[model samples]
Target: MSYGDDSKKKRRLAVIGVSSLLLVAMVVAVTVGVGLNNDSNENVNDSSHKSTSQVSPTVKAVKAICQPTDYRKTCEENLQKAAGNTTDPKELIKIAFKVAEKHINEASKKSKLLEELSKDPRTRGALQSCKELMSMSVGELRQSLNKVTDFDLSELEKLMEDVKTWLSASITYQETCLDGFENTTTNAGKEMKKGLKVSMELSANLLGIVSGLSSAIPSMEAFSRRRLLQDDLPVLGHGDQFPTWADFGTRRLLAAHVSKIRADIVVAKDGSGDFSTIREALPHIPHKNTKPFVLYIKEGIYHEYIEFNRSMTNLVVIGDGKEKTRITGNRNFVDGINTYHTPTVGK
Candidate 1:
């Protein structure tokens, strides 16, 4: 070959060699980057799978427990988060009660803050009512918790009744809190509603679990009959003067002789009893009555709007007859009296 041709050929070979080296380096870099990315993704997938696969025992239990509830997702999330990995049913129940109690207490606190934020009197009143009702609900929840904490499946009648009553009361109090805000255009209602929503759900969940507690417990059905058969049959019996609704206490009171009724105050409106008017006798009622305080309202058309408030607990006011004893009042919404304050007899 000639010298020029050989030089040109050498230059071409050199250029080809450089291009091949650069192409190989680029391929290797691209392959390594892709490999690294795939490895990173694989690691993430493995971690995610591991996390989901190892479902906690408590989570499983919560799901099972809340399956029959009205608010399943809420119950599961709340109970699962609070109880962690424990699977014990009793412990789960206690944890559920605690969760409800805690949330209700927090709502009660928030209602006070909401009251402070609101300037409208009606809103303030509603907030105050919410605070009071939430407070009562918390108290009822605590009572239910205590019963569940050291309860008797053997005394199924009393235990079940008590638990059901308290839980129902708690749920009712929460509803009452919301009800006060109803039929009004108040922003506080939304805040109060939002604040109380979860607690109410928790309370309902607690009640549902407790209602099915017989099945949850081992061999509770066998002994449930013992107490219920003996105690419940008579109470459930439909008969004579006492209606189905009246309890043994009220039935006994209604059946008792007039002479047996021990009265702390009496009203006759004819200067025959302890006081002429019902309002006059209210002031004489004991400031604090742990026992039953009987206020015998005689047969008369009393022209007064009576109200028994929070401080007056266990005051049994018996009248002559439903038709015979009449309470009349003229104060009404149309006559300038506020609707709330216009009730003839309020408690």
Candidate 2:
């Protein structure tokens, strides 16, 4: 071996040393990057797990409450949003009621659109009836809210009675609204029906909750004693004579003694009283009348159409008999007019 050979061996040793250092550096960088990536993935997964683990109390409460309802998914989704994080049963029930109120308000607004778009008198009349029914439902729901706000644990019976009455009335109003659209086949009618059906289901669910709460009330001796001491006794009647469907107020109105009740406006064909046609008497009555405004229709066939507008409140029309005091109109769907606009009796 000479000096060149020795120099070549030195170069080769230096090159090998440099190459080993570079390879070590590369391995270290790769290991560090892989560890960092693994840590980042673990942190991401942990964050996702934590978020999922923290389910809202209100969401659970809504799910539990709405589980037994007719519209479980609808009730849960709506009520969960309304309730936030509240888990209290009473609060949950109140939230459910609010949801019901919201749905009914939307339904009422939607039904009003039908009236505006209606080309037929009958369809308009039906839509008007739907609107009126929805309005009544909203009124009853408001009344229910008032009662719920005033609910007392001591006077459980009274509280339960008021709740049942108002909620039942609300349900009935929605049912009546759907009944108005029974024979409708139009797209508008279908949409109205669908909207009202959801409202009705929501109303029914609220009513069910009220009823369930009422049933859960403990029957203490005090409640029984109070009931026994009450002066106003339940009336007994023949099964066939008394209508099971009539409410307390309606029953009182239908009593034979109520015939003596004076009329606010009287309509007679012979011009014996205030107005000849029912239409003439309507305008005379005050708009947004708070008190009961009764109209007495005399026995005679009146060949005229009648409409009670939205502004009229608490207006009651009484006749001698359904057949004896009849109102007949010529307008119909076949007369090149929208059926909604053709009703002899419309709102």
Candidate 3:
């Protein structure tokens, strides 16, 4: 070949070598880019994991508060749901009671609705009892809620007592509502029992928490579960005639002899007192009072059922003797009356 043709061939060979180098560089760049994209995806995944691990402070507070409760899971979940940035124990308790109130009211409404479906007289009576008792349960829960909200540190002992009493009674009322269903051959009893189970459990759990308040509040250090659990409650004494927790009105009434009581009104089988029947004397007493009002009963086996409503507060009834002055009731479940309504004395 001539010298010019050989030079042209060398130029073409040089161009081919440069193209190979360029292709190699592009391959290296693509590999590096792919590695960087994978690293970026991994970083995004790490951030996502970090986000899921985070928890709300309010939820943390709820879990912590309900940790010691008997129904911890239920309490925690519900309180968490209703908890809106509240870290205050009192507010949490109030919220718990509010939740309980809602559940109890739901049970009450269920009882009424169940009543409409029941044809059995016993079932009807039980539903009626449940309706009334659930109302009482709601009232007691409200009382507890209010006390926790407005309680004074100076009166911590009384506050604990009142809260304990109210919460415990609410649980009892819920149980009593179910009790009315027993021995009946209808599905209503079972239904009501199922419906009321949660309400009762909530009340019980709240009572336990209230009983444990001494551990949480420094001011309640003087109170404890031991004092609350005494079998001899309405305690006669700590070595005295009566316990310190007894109200003045209660102490006075319990200590007083029949002769010492001045009658605001009297009931007798004989035509000697203000009225011949105890029922008649009920309306004569004041609808409300701050001081104790005494009603004296003369000796006789009176065939009557006595009842007092919520409005009749601070009233005392004294009988001549348990054996001599007797009150009798004719109500029974077999006679289509609820056992709740069968008591000789109902409050």
Candidate 4:
């Protein structure tokens, strides 16, 4: 071992020691950086989770409107309030039906349409549909009422009550529309024409609702007492035998009774001649006749528009067969035609 050799050994040893210290410092710094980063990330996640848990789902304000405890009083109050706040016809109709149902006289129950309402299921269904329409109309009226600024709440309530009475009378009239005219012919023939005529009147203007109803009640009561309410005579028994229309037996009886009204002329279309539009014949119909212009439409399709003035009262358009006969016209809400102007397919 010489002095030069010792110096070289010390230099090598120093170099090895410095390299070991540098490696240890780097490992400690990396461990501390990773631990701090994990703690910060955990805090951020916890805050985010708490926020989500505290949040709530949104609710609608309109749905908060509560139903009334006393359906009558509540309906009346809500109706008045809604009418004052809105002008929706549907609301008015709602008030109307409620009023009618509540106030309907038990002893004075009358309606030609209602006479068979229980016996014929179809009449009941039609009545339900008519009621739904009335409700919808009232809703629309409610919306309109809400928009009016000048109406006091009490005034609106009173007016709505009156409207309800008028509508009730109208519905009753609709029921009795068929009972106005009588046929001395076979019971079935008479009843069928009556049913058809009642349907025709109902399909017309809603204005005649009160007058038509006022006249119909007494007639139904009288018919009920006489057992003449069962208009469908000759109860065509189970499909054992079929009767031909040309036999001239039932047909003659029907023609004789219906013709006496003097307000109608039936022209059966045999395909040999063209039909004059409803527009053409309406002018000739007399107002003084207070009778329907009965059109005994043959089983065929009539594609045209039909319009009737106030004078076209007691009108009836009957088809030989519902399936073979169609009176179709397309009019929608956007077409500017009133909801009542929509076309119908009837028998």
Q: Which 10 residues in a row give candidate 4 its minimum summed lDDT?
A: 58-67
Which candidate number has the best lDDT? 3
lDDT, candidate 3, 1-347, per-residue tens: 99999997886575445433332333344335544654667656987545534656566556555645788777877788787888655467678888888889999999999999888888898899999898888888887877765544445556667788888899889989988988888998888888877777778878876766634445325432234243444534356686555665678777888887778888888989889988888888886777778888899887888888766777778899988889887787778788999998888
lDDT of each: 0.72, 0.68, 0.74, 0.38
RMSD of each: 26.3, 26.8, 26.4, 35.3
Provide TM-scores for the models.
0.67, 0.58, 0.75, 0.27
lDDT value, residue 262 of candidate 1: 80
Candidate 3 to truth, TM: 0.75
- In candidate 1, residue 277 scores what lDDT? 94
Give candidate 4 regions above 4 Å deviation.
1-275, 288-293, 344-347
Ranking by TM-score: 3, 1, 2, 4
| lDDT at residue 344 of model 3 (Cα atoms) | 86
Highest TM-score: give the candidate number.
3
Q: For candidate 1, write residues 1-347 as lDDT tens digits.
A: 99999997886575445433332333344335544654667656987555644766556566656655788788988887888777655567778888999999999999899889888676676778777777778877887787666544344445656788889999998887777765555688888789989998888888777766534333435543545354655643345665554566766776777678987888997789999998988778875566667889888899998988656865778887789778998885445333455679985
Q: How much is 242 displaced in model 1, in angstroms?
A: 6.1
Q: lDDT, candidate 3, residue 334? A: 75
Candidate 4 lDDT, tens digit per residue, 1-347?
Answer: 99989996885565445333332333334335544554567667988555544532110110111111123334334345434443223334334333333322211233234434444433333333344333433333333333221222212333334443544444444343223222212243244344334222322222222222222334334322332355344433224243321223434434455424332443334543234344455566666444335655555566767655434444555555668766677865344333333554321
- Model 2, position 88, has a per-residue lDDT of 62
